[model samples]
Target: MSAELRDRFFALSTGGAPADEVARYLAEVDAVDTEPAATLDGLGISWHPTVRFKAVRFVDAERIDADVRELFARPSQEAPYLAAVFVDPRELSFRTFENIVPLDRLLADTPLDLDLTRRAELAEGAYSFSLRLPAAARGHLERLDALNLYVPPLNSGSRGGERFIFHSAQLAEALTKAVAKALPQPLRDGFSHVNPVFRCNRFEPGDANFHRHRDTPYYDAERHHVSRYTLLLYLTGGSATPALDLTGGVALAEIEPFTCVIFDQRYEHEGAPYDDGRKVFLRTELIFTFTESEVTHDPEIGALFGKACYWTGESVFAPELARHADAYYNQVAAAHWSALTPGADREPFVHKQFRGVHFVANGYDFWFAKSDKLSLAECAAITLLDYFNCKLGDTSFRALCQSEVIEADEADAAAWIPGFLQDKRGDSAVPPIDKSLLFPEPEEANNECCPFHSWAAFDATRSEDVIELYTQAQTFAKAHILPAPIVMLGEDVLLDPDKFVIRGNSIHVLGKESLTPVNFAACWNAGGLPGNYIDIAATVDTAHFLVPPIFFTESDDCYHLRFDFFRNSWMVKHQQVTIPVPMVQDGVCDDGDPYPWRYAVDEVSLFTDNASDRGKADLWWVDNPAVEDEMRDVFD
Candidate 1:
């Protein structure tokens, strides 16, 4: 009620006005108290009176949600925040909706505490002095302008038997609608539909490190091309949080207060932890659907979906033999898989299985059994491949293409694979890689040379077996590496095997320092290792996904925006699309220094792109739609 109006009620009733006049005053409260909201236009204000208490709330919960979603979708130059305040339960007198007899006595029986003594006083020497309640809410006075309250029952403010209250019926109706969603009807017999309830979520400390993962939990991969928005609500402040920017992600919208962050969900993300305590929020989800009836209409969309279907697949791997073929393979070595336009000439692959294949194929797996000399070489190869995939997906590669995108030039890209990839930097006359080189430094540092690359290395006995996979991979790579309009590759070089480790199966022999991979991928193009090619955290693990490639602003930063899949990473560069990724040192290279070819990027556990397993066999299966036909055809 308006303060002006509320004053009137207390004015007449406080000191006990005459009995006859009391009836007149009660009637006044009734009229305003039971008032109905005018319309949706009056959404900002509302009140509803049950028998004894007035239930109040904002009438436009729906409006607020929509607006927040819109705001979240906007990209902002400022750090965003979204905050909400909930009345602390310990402070509120929730007598209208819950069983409160026990609580009432607890307060009544308590000795006068400093905070409440002033408000709770009993008249001296009276037969039964009336008890006054203390103010029971935080930030209550400041928001009284937008407040709702419930008053107690008649004559003596007693309990039970009474089953009603009065207020703006609009308030009552709104709560009914909001709470109704959390409950199902017919299953309940009473006014639960009328009672108001809200879920409480609190943030607590979670796992330590961040996990980079890409997923579409709400929609089917094939049917939905994009989701419009994501809303994350905060209930309280705390230290731990799970949210991060990963490669291949861009803000189609934004993040901020009372804001709804709407972005292209394809951008991979990570759930990072905040050191400070931040509370968990009540989360709401919404999706804009097309064609409501059975979700069917045209066949063209079916084809588009089929082409883009890799969005749902789990990434797999080919042997590492091809990954170490110098710089070209180094890039893809870190990726899950390479995304390529089907057929020659960058065709969109009108076939269902080809669309978006690169991203789906990008984030894959390669592991080292034990640390040893052979494993390091194998890891170098496999890791480089994954990296190549990530590099292609990143902004670094996008900036390289001229005319620019390789997605349009399949032939040069495919043909350039071997020689350019093997050892592009052996020549000394080549220029050092330019920050603006866009493409990996040497044209020759591409996918050609096939060192003993494999997480498991060349088990002398299995050498022949590994060779076949390498040959196939090289062939597969040649088909997709496009002819230039300036082809820039987005890829990562994963060091998943125990590179140079002194222990077990992955012993990376600290042998003759070989900058072969670096020379091939970067310098080969420029004809020499770039003065400052980046080094990312190329990890290796045996049991957990051996190596997961994620590009970062700083080579060691795993929390930056990452591309969890190869397809998306490949598409971004190959297609030459602009997206946000951090920019590191961009000036002249660190003065003609050799690339840091051998470095220790710890074994990290990546929040793999794809879906979270809710506990099933295989955790992932080759048959998953994202892979299946697409892999079969590509591998063939």
Candidate 2:
């Protein structure tokens, strides 16, 4: 069982049902000394220690019939739960129960007329006009009405409902037969059975209000089997009717008594608040297995719950998930709206290879049915499409080009977005680096921090301007302290003008002036400076170096030693020092590193000739006057 279902199943098992129902359910749980199992037989499948009484009493025959047909017509994903509930099943005889009010009696009490002004503007009619209950079915309806009904808590805040049930074996048998006969042959074969997960609602001037949301949870990674249909039965009537949104489009309908609307639970819908008078209704789910083969012949004990699934009804509130869903919908199913409209004049715009395109969003892969006749809007309404469009942005809802996607199989498709899985590309992709090998181990903290860029001389044709920039850099460095700023004066293209910017927590960079505002908060959170930077006269021998070469660590985290070919010695920034080695070690750094040391000119003497070499010699690392120890000896 999924965490979601486990939570819900326990919630249902512990509370929300009649006392007897709860007791019976618990008894079954106690009886199961082993693993939880369902009561399976040729008669039909049901949960063990089942609540025996039928829940729904009277249903809007016309409305429910239409829903049943529509449900059977669509794919499995669309109708996760289509339901119908029997309302007032009062005991009329020893064997069966009867509905409190007959259709004629109901009509006499509450007459309905299709006024143009009052007509529901929804895609499907608001009030069911086809409420013709057969004469033979009236007793069954009464028996359904006599059933002990239970209404679960509608909202977390409100408390105004009751749960009840009186099990009747005769009624269950009759209702089961009716339900089986009602389904088409194909659906009957595939259908497992229906269980009583019922709800009764009382709509008053202040109480009848429900937000728009999808029903059953959507499945993504799991292979869980959940109920495929949600059955609803309306049993009361009043002057005020709530507006309902349907699959095809928005429609206004009456919330009159005996009016039930069964639809795919995936459809994103809403129940408009009601105000005029009191009304009551009952609802139930018609559960079906996803495939016919899932119905096993053996009727032994097994798992009570199947795999877990998740609902995306509340997903619209999440921005990231919504954005991706919108993109997927636009890429896969946006172009097929015209074909789904009842009387739209446009021809069926068919794309040969694009029919099976799937939108992979938030882990779920949404693919159109084989017919490919459903409208984009319809598909979007059921899936996460509208949430994306409403919150993220509008999706063009056009069919993607054939070249952009590849069909995986009969029921699956994959879109070929560029850069997706680009890392896996062979020759064209950047070669992977073994990150572990690139950096010193965490234990070697001193060796794990290295200079990323090198010291450069403050250089400029106008010596005064160079001096001014160097002074500014020094002042900034003094103010910010640790991770002393490395000042570079050469015209390196990488440094387009000099300005300070924060990169991570407490880590700032004197980057190009064109870069965006630095996130100082991020820098402060990262602690102090990343590494040290220093300004020197001229690191190389060039009289007018166009760009100063940066002496940085091979890796960001590692402080491992590297030979600076220009300086000709082992280089690791500890407290900073200069030790000249022979020129034979030039290019001694790793060959695989993209930034390799290159020699400028070998065999240069560090012995300066007085003041002329004064400014330029600053590029060479200097021993700290305070530390009497030789810097080279520390490395040894």
Most accurate candidate by TM-score? 2
Which lDDT value does model 1 have at 6? 40
Instruction: Look at candidate 2 and tell me the lDDT of residue 473.
Output: 29
lDDT of 2: 0.27
In terms of lDDT, the poorest run of 10 residues in model 2 is 299-308
Stretches of model 1 off by over 4 angstroms after superposition: 1-413, 422-636
What is the alpha-carbon lDDT for the whole of candidate 1?
0.25
lDDT of 1 by residue, 284-368 (tens): 2233343445333332222223222221111111112111112122222222122322333342210111111111111222222
Which regions of candidate 2 fall more than 4 Å away from where they truly are? 1-173, 184-189, 217-225, 239-241, 247-252, 273-275, 292-636
Q: With candidate 2 superimposed using the best TM-score fit, by how many Å does residue 314's alpha carbon deviate from the native? A: 17
User: Least accurate stretch of 10 residues (summed lDDT) in model 1?
Assistant: 598-607
Per-residue lDDT of 300 in model 2? 10
CA RMSD of all predictions: 29.0, 30.5
Q: 197 in model 2: Cα distance from truth in Å?
A: 2.6
lDDT of 2 by residue, 481-538 (tens): 2221221112110111112232222112231112110111000011112211112223
